[model samples]
Target: MPSRLLPPAGPARALAAAQLVNALGDGAFLVTSALYFSRVVGLPPTRIGLGLTLAWAVGALAGVPLGQLADRRGPRTVAVLLAAATGVSVGSFLFVRGFLPFVLAACCYATAQTGLAAARQALLAALVARRDRTHVLAHLQSTLNAGLAVGAAVGGIALHYGTRAAYLAVFAMDAAAFLLCALVLLRLPEVGPTAAPAAPGRGPRFTVLRDRPYALVTLLNTLLLLRMPLISLAIPLWTVTRTDAPGWLVSALLVLNTGAVMLFQVRTAAGVRDLPSAVRTVARGGALMLASCAVFALSAVDAPVWGAVAALLVAGGLQVAGEMMQSSGAWQIGFDLAPADRQGQYQGFFGMGVPLARMLGPLLLTALVVDWGTPGWLLLGALFLGAGLALGPAVRWAERANSALVSVG
Candidate 1:
């Protein structure tokens, strides 16, 4: 890659490279996992869904403990181990012959993936400056989008060929990606022996569990993360069922989002310096999302194909922009509010929202945004706005409760 294309040659790029690698694997898995199980592994869709749901739930529960391990031992060592474990677990899918085996493998895969996510965040918090973590994460997210797009394309090719060999190849590639991700991670230095556990654990091993304010913040963030499913589920479903726009628009809107993030996420993140700025940015992002919901509602109206396309495009743009803002702000807040030594556990707890969102968002959004139509879209937007606004008070509460840090907001 050109120098301009690379993040400065350091842990940031190393992290980005590792992210891109796993994202490629994840991309392949996301595109083909369902089809592979149904067509080749011989599991029903309902079983597949149930197994994955169970797996991610297990994974979400596993995150904090794993992260605490990272803090106890070392983020780099734990991250590398978890990365390799994820590769092995994903590879386990190739041997799965029944739902029981599949569920077991899926659980292992999800747990390792979830743990790796927390470990990586812990590593980022350890290696990157507090101020720059959000920007680095932005770059990682951009790399993730790029890698997923390419991996999805690879999966698409396998689908086009419609062969068992091609399908297996996608899984194989995905497994390899995580293994390669582990290798990339190995190049980075450990963030040192984990700082001695704060005061040798005065309370619960995972204090983050008892942290009501952080939990509240995570909850609100999880609500905002509904936009995540909105991207993957609601918008595509809405486009297909409710709008007159062409089918290709489904993909185009996704591309618009991916491309926009790649182009703009870093720049968008530059303004968020601390908790207060993060809060304001999130609020503004919420308003943008509110407007986006309204625009999407317009697409359901009786309009020319072009008009609907325009509305969808406008909505998509606003949604992505809002996504960039909230994501950047959330990253900063997740880091800024945590005790410096407890980043691993804090990040682990904070990241629970992701798996939770993945588990819950689809079912919830399908009911609210897709099935309910325009009314649902508006209602969901209101939910987003409300959540974004709630973060301010939640952070205030967190700041007051967390004695290790001063209330910056």
Candidate 2:
């Protein structure tokens, strides 16, 4: 019965299906990417990291322009083209023999992926009502995780085989998935640009860069997103090195996170109907994350193995709760605060935070929490609390400014 509670038919379902397929491919690729590059492709570890890092940077830079293009053209059209490009770029990885070719292929894949994401968000905004956007987003997130879980399992087969041919097969599957996703997108109804004509000299180009309140909100949301690395990278390392918990608990923690999102992401989105409610959701999520941080700190204590495992489970649950809440709230804020006409550009700018977090989070968390231990966790908690508290005021400021702009116009 719960499985039957799907997204409504039409564009929403289509988009969700496409995202599920694409994300499944991403999940498979992610599992094998590092190993495939190093072992199969024969690139050095440092080169792989460097290439991926440069790729991400290139992708981040591509977002704004591609999003703007989506606004100028149709989002559906742009999205389809970008998806095709992504598939081609990813498939090209099979031919990469050295650092330069690898980096080049990575940049292409990352750029297309980023651009496709912005286009997809804009397309979603076009298809769904403002009131329903966050709800739809929640469903999409759940579907993505589910697909990723399945894909990761499939990828594990290749990992187990540990053969070049098997890895290539996985890469080919990922490429095909992207092309399939593109076909799915083609089935959706075409939605054109929402922007109205600008007055004599006042164009909309780069306007998101100048919007201070929205910019601040994006910054705060990015800080909140640091939870990603904390769970994925730091927690596992901490569990093995510092805690008394068994190594198997690391897998359990990841499953806990993915399982929570699949089960509760949609449920959590129900309460976030308006800007005020969204803001409250984010604040509450921040508090939950702060508490989770403290709990995670407790896991590092000199406790019995069972006690540490219990602490880890509890902390992981809290972190997932916080993630679902914050994610839903952030989607609402990003969608609601943007000028309706420029959703593509605004969403593109908002998305820049993700790549930035991915770039900086590991170093920051490793230095603060991983290296320093309990004090680092406490400091991270303080950061979360401070950022969460600041969100309410920041959102209010953005709303007022937007209202002022509307009245002036």
Candidate 3:
């Protein structure tokens, strides 16, 4: 850590640190949110889940518009605004006694989160060179997970000892992080949006949807996202309410998942960094996810607790592997392909698929399960596997298109 040898200690570095801090707070807040809604606010699981869906929908709908705004202004300015807005929104939760006000606060927080996310990703791409982009993105994910580990542990402790005060503390920390992030962003050199790159001939922004290869990548992302509901809402509810498992098992399972991330994500992610093959990377990630789902399906057979635990560990490892591939591929395509001017818009539009899936997937799975029993989970697994298989053609198309483009240039 010699001073002269260190990477530039500017806005980019500062913003990355600030993201870690804010993520820590977010992690703590999420850990307590469900319990707070249930015990403090007296909302049932279904209502809580519905609220999450609404928040996600609001965020997803706002993402593209926020990105467009970031293009007009600067990504830094938009990011700062988003951070401050999120801080205020989270702090407002303290006074919200009823469902309506609470939900409103959640919606506001979600909207700000999406805005900040678009700005953050765009900022990263703008700051880095093409060769280093994948490494930087991987580092960001690892840093976030590290922050989450600390936050989650602290949150659990806070809940066990302090209850509602703990959650409030988490929000307060988030607010502070937002303020710090804004300050750090102000110190960094302003990087203009993609509409105004230094290079000649390339336009300010390339329309991502019009590019079939990128569009297919986005579509694959959406399809992959549909698989997340199993872990996010469906499996937890099924395990806690539908099965004989104890409520504490949910926490245990999460621990297993987090542990796998801690142990495996970085090492696994390095192998897949920003190769020219988006489709192949995505396919690999999808295949791992499919395997994880199959393991999850096996858990439905009334195995012993140890057997279930084993399945959980295996599934969790698969999740980490999938995440590594998906994350690497996503940054490679979204950041590398975009010209300097429109990175914000491209990343923003592409990232919306995540929130869209979050909103839609759970509802569909829940309804199907209610109507079809175990068949719903089976169908979900099938969808994941099919999505993985379908990515082969998409990847081939991307490879050929890229080759043709390179040849023409």
lDDT of 1 by residue, 26-139 (tens): 887898889999999889999998999999899999999999989999999999999999989988888999999999999999899889999999999888888788878888
For each candidate in the order shown, give its overall lDDT on alpha carbons. 0.90, 0.90, 0.70
Query: TM per model?
Result: 0.96, 0.97, 0.83
For 261-371, candidate 3 gives per-residue lDDT tens digits of: 555554555554454465467668877876776666666567777676666557666765776676677667667555466777777777887888888987787776434
Candidate 1 residue pairs in clash (backbone atoms < 3 Å): none
Stretches of candidate 1 exceeding 4 Å from the true structure: 1-4, 195-201, 404-409
How many Å off is the CA of 184 in candidate 1? 1.1
Model 3 lowest lDDT segment of ten: 1-10
- Please say which candidate is ahead in TM-score: 1 or 2: 2
* Model 3, global lDDT: 0.70
- Residue ranges of candidate 3 with Cα displaced over 4 Å: 1-15, 41-47, 161-164, 196-213, 238-249, 273-275, 367-375, 395-409
- Candidate 2's residue-wise lDDT over 126-206, tens digit each? 999989999999999999989989999889999999999989998999999999999999999988877654577786577
Candidate 1 has an lDDT of 0.90
Best-fitting candidate, measured by TM-score? 2
